[model samples]
Target: MLQMAGIAVAGSCLSPTYASKSRLLVSIPAQLHREFTPPLPAFISLNQRRREVLPSKSLQTALIRCFDTNKAASAESEENAKPNKVYFARDAIVDAAARIAPAVANLYARKGGQEEEGEMGSGTVIHEDGYILTCSHLFFNKMDVTYAADEEIIVCTQDKEIGHVVDAYVDLDIAIIKIDSPSSPLSTAKVGSSSKLRPGDWAVAMGSPLSLQHTVTLGIISCVHRKSYELRREGMAMEFLQTDCAINPGNSGGPLCNVDGELVGVNVETMKAHKASGVSFAVPVDLISAIIKPFQSCQMPVQPYFGWVMRNVRKENLEALKQYYPTFPNALEGVFVQKVIKGSPADRAGIQAGDVVVDFDLQQIRNIKEMMDVMVKRSGTPVDVIVERLMLGKNRLVHLTITFEEKDVAAPRPRL
Candidate 1:
């Protein structure tokens, strides 16, 4: 089941920048309703975004002066006076869209010998050897039988091709599909650095939203990290790149490109309704870099699922905590547990908010990324964690044993 990104309410709200009533609706795939029993709608809010300020008055006046014409001027002289700002970026976007469109696949799934009519979601070609990356949820069905070796799944790009699931990592909602012996080498996407993305950077989302093939939407990055509020209910401590890119149902698993047409993220979630311009989320490209080699090689890497999100302890946050609790840990190097999912491995082990994870299985965890690496390296094994718990105006050292589960959507257990 899909969950909302943030708090959502049913009503219409006027957007200051967009001269339209922006309504909020869920972007859950329509195939879920047609192919199987329909689930309840995921409520997500599309909050009004910050507006971009116009250029300075001096610059505008100068442009106006350049374009201003005398009564004696001819048409040829008027054309020469127009501003000639070199904009190669527009051509780059168009070229990139054309180059990448053939690699984006429209997925189709079957259950009990019945084929779904429409596309499930979009996918990206990560390798010229026919390796595709998509969301894991797209492979799931409400059928009793597993997919057969042949004719169970098909991928539609420039031509329809049989696709087989190579590997999947449910924690990041990433799935790898291989086209069964393609005719020729496919066009691969140019991956960009998500670590370098800023809040106001230009973003372009390309996908088959609502089955509209090759649709592209433009927006700016609203936030680098938008944590899911319904993490406990969803069983995944999810983080996403929040943007007002107008993503719809079929947009999931498509490429979220930067201004230079490089893939910065994989489009995953969105907020949309009857009359809403939605906010979309993407899995950062940096996260993919860690395991792309294994994924391309058709190997399932161990993605640790602890059911909690953490962040590096900044000096400002440490100062605030110290002021509130006088005995807060003086040691500044550790990851702070921000949220722990209910009934998860971390929750069962008694992890809580305001707890600083000092050590993981005897290894010091300096940041959240380091913690993730530790989890991946020690998959399916019980590990001891040393956390400094704050209670009664003092910091107490606590040791907890937690076994992380490998992220698998096919398993009956909880997945990330």
Candidate 2:
């Protein structure tokens, strides 16, 4: 044997501690290189051959099974303690706001000399590709001025930084707007049944109050099926949703979302601000479907009544009128009978000039529009009516079964 000599080296240099952990780690190299094989432990003789076979899939499956068993056990352990859902526990209402914010939009209107400022109104996003539902008042051509096609209408939202206008609708008070996200993905509120939205279920309204955009207010659905809006021939009957959501001039056409974030009503006509010490009104989504249906049919529905002309009557005059309306509800039930046009539906229904309409179909008539609504919706449908002879103490609640008489279709009235 050749004499082997070596200088003294530290014990750390050839450490025995790592020998127990030593093993061969193998990989197929891209390029074949010369590699000297390391010797096995003395427990294995040099004559003993090494098994260089691939690991069996049975072994892999066994490892996976063990891991799965541990995981399932852990899952069962966790399941023993029921975790509280953060949304229902605390963020139920907040999540609703987030869901509904995408649908509501603002409206802007400016008359000829109204300082070129815009009026704030709300609208619902009814269609994904851009369709919305709002009140006629928002699009009511009070000034006969057309809003620009790309009017800078602001879309306010909840659970967000602020609101910005996305787009505008010219004919419909409804304005559809896409969210600010470059990504088109957004959570939209599922519209609920206005017919089923009871008077007690949670009622919520979103509006930009007094320049504060996307302000959320809460109230109960105070009433349902309240008489509202004049009816139109060939249009769906208007059944209203009345609420106390503190709606105002700005709240017109806002969405009255339910607790589930479903739109129960469209914030439409509200009580006059001074008259609104507490009450606010919304056009039920059921009725909204009617107003929009004619447009969908590509034809304008004939609204029977014109705009309401408001005027206050003195207490003495109101009392004097009550003498002729003993069957009417005190003195506030009926207003002065204006000129009824010849050959109109009101005229066909025998509602003549100087006829004081005290009540219609058991509903106490407070204004012309409400009475017109009942008469129009019930067109061809009979109703019990109460009217006082013009300037006479005699009054009668007559069940007048009105019929829909076709008038001259030569020239149609303007869209309301």
Candidate 3:
């Protein structure tokens, strides 16, 4: 899902950024099977990484240079001296990078039904215990092997060695991963209530945009209470915190924080057509919280589901319902119920399709979200349903009690 900033991660960890250098060392014991190492060992420079080190004065100097040299250090400085902070923003991002990047990990995986390397994705470490949250597709198949951060994960300010996801549910398109890393720099971002965000609020996205580690981009809330789906991603239904933030490929699973860096949402998708522009999208933080209960302590609690769909009335179709619905107050511009599923609490309460649901209890219904808010609070018990049913071009006031059924989470739904 590391595909887009507004639409999806297209739903993965990230796109590819093959490292061109052969200098970085890697070592995997030959006894280690595919279960613990990459399936295709050829693509990886294992021999180069496996070079052994010896302890000596010269080795000490080499090791020290490797450990202490910062990316900010110039080639000349790195050759003769230790590294120092050269830029303010880099310093700020690096300051929190270790703590934050651990949550955002690079995911290497296999392509669908093929014996080849698939694309990569990123993840966010939500739990200090090493639990992470990422787009589920990053681990999309029977993985031949997996890897995490190495000694240099800190250099990337990312968790180098992350535990692969042992469990996943694509219905939510979200996964929980166990990772290993040092203490975080930024406290896990404060998971604030999503309902607090409004259009035009400040937002900052932090992650490996385009696979460049610890990238940050800023924007404002473009819209809220989104009720949309990613048609390309098999119609994954996801309500998001729409923002103009510049979310690119590798930003998936990273945090969309407020001005103060409180976790508001997971950078998920970006809306795009022919040409890419400023529009971006993110998973609602509350939804991310709901999908993965594993991060409950680190994520905001999710609001409940109301479970219905409605539409605003169009003047062209208004005459068709003039008979049974008469309360033309304000032209019924609010959302109207289209269909209520059978055995749904609405059906149990005697509500039917074609019923123009105007309000719930007393709260006026706007769209799916507001109605859900009204119904979800009354989860088990019945609540009053107010509607104006069209009967022979006349308005008929109808009040029926409705209840909400527990959302059937296993109905082949997308990884929410």
Q: TM-score winner among the candidates?
A: 1
Per-model TM values vs. the true structure: 0.50, 0.40, 0.41
Model 2: how far is 392 from its true place, Å? Answer: 45
Candidate 3: regions farther than 4 A off: 1-103, 109-119, 141-159, 180-187, 229-236, 291-416
Candidate 3 C-alpha lDDT tens digits along 1-416: 11222222222223323222322212222323434554431122123544332222222322333323123334464356543434235344334433343345555542242322332456665555555566654443212111121111111223344243433433344555544334553234446667789898877777776557667787889888666653233323457778888877767767777655567777776766456677777777676454333344433232122233344454534554444334343345445544343344455577654666677778887443455455445534557877766666666767887654443332221111
Give Cα distance to truth, residue 196, candidate 3, Å: 0.8
Per-residue lDDT tens digits of candidate 1, residues 119-236? 6788888776567878755653211112222334567776777666554444456666767667787777777788899998888888887778889888889898777663221323
Q: In candidate 2, which residue ranges exceed 4 Å CA deviation?
A: 1-90, 110-118, 141-188, 229-237, 290-416
lDDT score, candidate 2, position 166: 25
Better of 1 and 3 by TM-score: 1
Ranking by lDDT: 1, 3, 2
| lDDT for each candidate structure | 0.64, 0.48, 0.51
> Which 10 successive residues of model 3 have the least lDDT summed?
142-151
| lDDT for each residue of candidate 2 in 1-416, tens digit (9 for 90 to 100) | 01111111222236556433543122212111212333333222123244222112213322222222223234454335343332323566777777787766655543432323545676665544233455544533322222222222334333221222222221223333323332232234467778887777778898655655677887888788775333221122345677777776777777898888888777765666664555767766654343333223212234222212111122435654345434333334454433333443455567543455567778877544465456445533345666555334544444443443332344332111
Give the Cα-based TM-score of candidate 2 against the true structure.
Answer: 0.40
lDDT of 3 at 277: 71
Leading candidate by lDDT: 1
